[model samples]
Target: MRVKRYIVNALPEAVSMIRTDLGKDAVILETKEIKVGGFMGMFRKKRMEVIAAVESGASKQGGTELPQRKPSPEVNAVVEQILQTAQRSSAAAAVMEPPAQPDPPVSDKRMEREQFIINEIRDLREYMVKLSRQQSDLHALSEPMLALKERLQEQELDSEWIDKLIEALSESEKSADRVYDRVELWGEAKHMLEEWLQPYNNAEISRDARVVHFVGPTGVGKTTTIAKLAAEQTIKRGRNVGFITSDTYRIAAVDQLRTYANILNVPLEVVFSPMDLPKAYKGLSDRDLILMDTAGRNFRSELHVSEVISLLQSNEPNETVLVLSLTGKTADMAIIAERFSKYGIQKVLFTKLDETTVYGAIMNLILKYGLHPTYLASGQNVPDDIERFKAGKYVELLLGDAEHE
Candidate 1:
């Protein structure tokens, strides 16, 4: 390869010089306008600096031709910059002088060069943008932004969402041209999170559904969650509530719910399988609200999910709430959410919130699987420990500022 640099009054003169020196196979690799011949830095003449290259083995006599080598990334970047300068120069020239069409070969060659430059520019732009964004995320964050990021990461948030939140904060700070203090940062985080989750802020279970079923994996407190919700209906609302349990696999589960049923004075019915659903429904037919409990099993298996969905089947107006414990791993919780989502169980209830500090799984499940979070159970204290999933309150807990309340 042969490369030469030329300086002239403008790009057109430089192009003519390059063609005479480097032949038809020559390519303009770079172009820039620079100031030259300054007198005490007072005045200078603008000259177009052009860098052109040609294949060393190609025949100038149009006999033998060497293969054109692909440009390196550095070469591509240089060419892209050159193309921008060329476009600006051409635009200025178009306004200053009348246009003249080039010969067929010259026009075709120019088009090929432009098309090549555009393709290289697009690829280079995309790669550079992603690289810059990653670098910015890694290093450009201020102390306050980093603090908030660390806080959310500790709460087990997905990296994808964390970036979105941090980027929004970055934009806000950039616009205002000021760094926020801890209190201000907390306030911004709460506001943004609540806004993002506001669309899914259906905290209460549907009162319209006469029968509500609770399903979950073993030891996730499905029975206890049913008890808590039942207490709400019985004690708070004074509504006629009934309990039906198919948790015969665990005798303790049935007993736990039965104890709550006896205390609430709500009728209790136990069924071993889905076949007994009709008879149990008939027994609780007089009840205005029926809270049904399904046996918890390995949720990872599609077979178990199918079985649980079968038990949840009812012709009456009903809703199924999938209970999950906060102590569970985020990945495991996502898997359960995925499995249950396949069965069309959209509503969810989280249990044992007092046991874990990471509330990210709530946002993860809600946003990712479109799960409607109905309630959160923090303790064993019947209805007092359970509450509807308020977005504002959850954001407060998520941001770790019970003191701000």
Candidate 2:
């Protein structure tokens, strides 16, 4: 795919520019309103910024061509009749002009305008309904497609993913039988889901990495997730694990990590400044694994994110795990991920899974950002609540089955 961006005064102008540059086959990926030519945020002109993409070989092939259809004799007769009727109506209106009278009440005029708009909207809706009915047979697989879309919406999947799935299924359905049973349709959907999720199946954290840092907004259970992984390394893998916390902003964040360190019999170092990070790492140099926890703040603020980045900069070859809460809004998750992306985030860690049933955000994040999730923390059960991420089991849960062990 080849992507390009265009900034224009209006959406239509942007579309025209995209067609001229990327051809008619170009797909609009994103669009947003932006301010330009403003001094200190005053008197700025609002403009539209559009991101468009086309297939790599689209230009060579002259883009996608529309199929030509010759109009039938009956259709041409109908069109000619409609044009003649419109011409007659226009001539009649022009010839029969009524004498001007006093203007009607302003309220009556307003009501008539409002009623006209309402009628136009109603007519448009009815026309669209008729059009859909006419094309229903062409879209014979719409039943299964609608069912899949409804299920995905109930699962709270992102619209982008749901639309992509529907598009893919629609293409596949064209070759299938005219009718489909619910079981067969569901089997096909499951197979498609598995294929879509296959790329995210590998979520294992590298054992060779010695330093792991967890960063995210407040109340995402970063410290607890680190503790869970720490326990897994120390007890299950028999690797020496140590704790380092730069989360002094929260009242009990340091103490919380310190408690976990005490329980695991590992050294805990609390650093107040970025300069203290080197000292803290030196203190835990002998350990096989060092887990670092940074203070959670409003990631929307660039200053706060920069502060966290400064602390993590000292730890070379460190894996930054961005912790996200499933209970939070997906829109917020997108913003958090975008802001924290400056830190070179390598892996994602989802927490509080037991608190919510929806798992679409997990898949959305993985697919959208290409971030591999290493662990999933379902509850607050110290080490027991966390588990390695498995794509197949995750998809099963999304399909409304209980999580498999």
Candidate 3:
């Protein structure tokens, strides 16, 4: 490679000089603006000093032997002078003396150029530091990430959910003073929470000639759950269970519940108005348990929700189970919980677990509101899919291990 330097009054001139000296094979290595000495350095001119190197293969004079190169004293002197000027400027700036003439404030253009260069240098330095930090972080995280990945795979967690779990783990790891210690702490907390969730399972309300109402939004398994509980009390427990449906809003829903009631050999009453709720309960008062099923109204519609809540309030069921679907978004679950919270939703019944692959949203809902889940329904089976709430089972399911007793 051939290296050379050019000093000219303008950048264009410097570029032209390098191009001419090294033909078209020149590669600019560095460029700097200088104040040329003219009239005792008072009348200064902008100059460009450029160093360029040319590749050997690209040289026009192919395999020709060249004479030994000699360094230019002028170039060496210029570099030395630049270094000395930098050192002197550093020393002078340290002393901090006021300038006599103030040297005329730098032009906006020059200031902008200098600022751009400074900004570029700062950005480059920051980028380099970030790259180094990321490298170290990746190296440190490799073992944990790998361990987590292996654990998740063995637990049969879907790959799509791995990123979310990893993110949660990473956040926990960062906030922890000691990662291993934090893991132990988190494990203990999880176990305690699981233990706390155990007693909440048998949410079965015992009523002797008392009206029990199940009310919530659409498709939350309100009708089916009413049938399930009604069947369990009537068939398994041998309680005189009577089913009442104000779900005359949907004839199909009424028919569905009536079918279940028929199978259980229980009396079924279909009511239309608020007045009908009391009348229906009175008709079934001869029975030991009266399970009233309400139509699934859209919770988002305030007017409809008010209507449902008004019905629930009028009936005043001993215990109201706010049926919430587990498959819904966490925000939607929260809104539903809040909406029904007014209706005195004492316990939460999460349904449709079999339909959803993710259960973290369930944990988020329960933890966010400190909700106590009354029961969990996994499938469409009346008395089979439904299981009492168990926090350990839920935590295991959430951690990608669904098979827990």
Off by over 4 Å in 3: 1-209, 314-317, 401-405
Top model by TM-score, which number?
Answer: 1
> Each candidate: what lDDT?
0.79, 0.73, 0.63
Q: Which prediction has the highest lDDT against the true structure?
A: 1
Q: Of models 1 and 3, which has the larger TM-score? A: 1
**lDDT of model 3, residue 192:** 48
Clash pairs detected, candidate 2: none
Candidate 3: tens digits of C-alpha lDDT, residues 58-81: 654221221123223322332343
Could you tell me which residue pairs clash in candidate 1? none
lDDT of 2 by residue, 1-405 (tens): 999998886544564466568765566555456789978989999886767778998762322322223333422332343344334434454456442556533355344534443443344344434444535523544555566666778878898888787667666666773544555656666788888778777777777678887889999999888888888888899999989998998998888988999999999998999788788888988999888899999987889888888877653566778899999998889888888775678588889989998888888887888788888888888789998888777877776531211
Clashes of each: 0, 0, 0
Provide the lDDT at 124 for model 1: 46
Pull out the clashing pairs in model 3: none
**Tens-digit lDDT track for model 1 on 306-364?**
88888887899988888999999999999999999987889899999999878999999
Quick one: ranking by lDDT, best first? 1, 2, 3
**TM match of model 1 to true structure:** 0.67
TM-score of 2: 0.66
Model 2: lDDT equals: 0.73
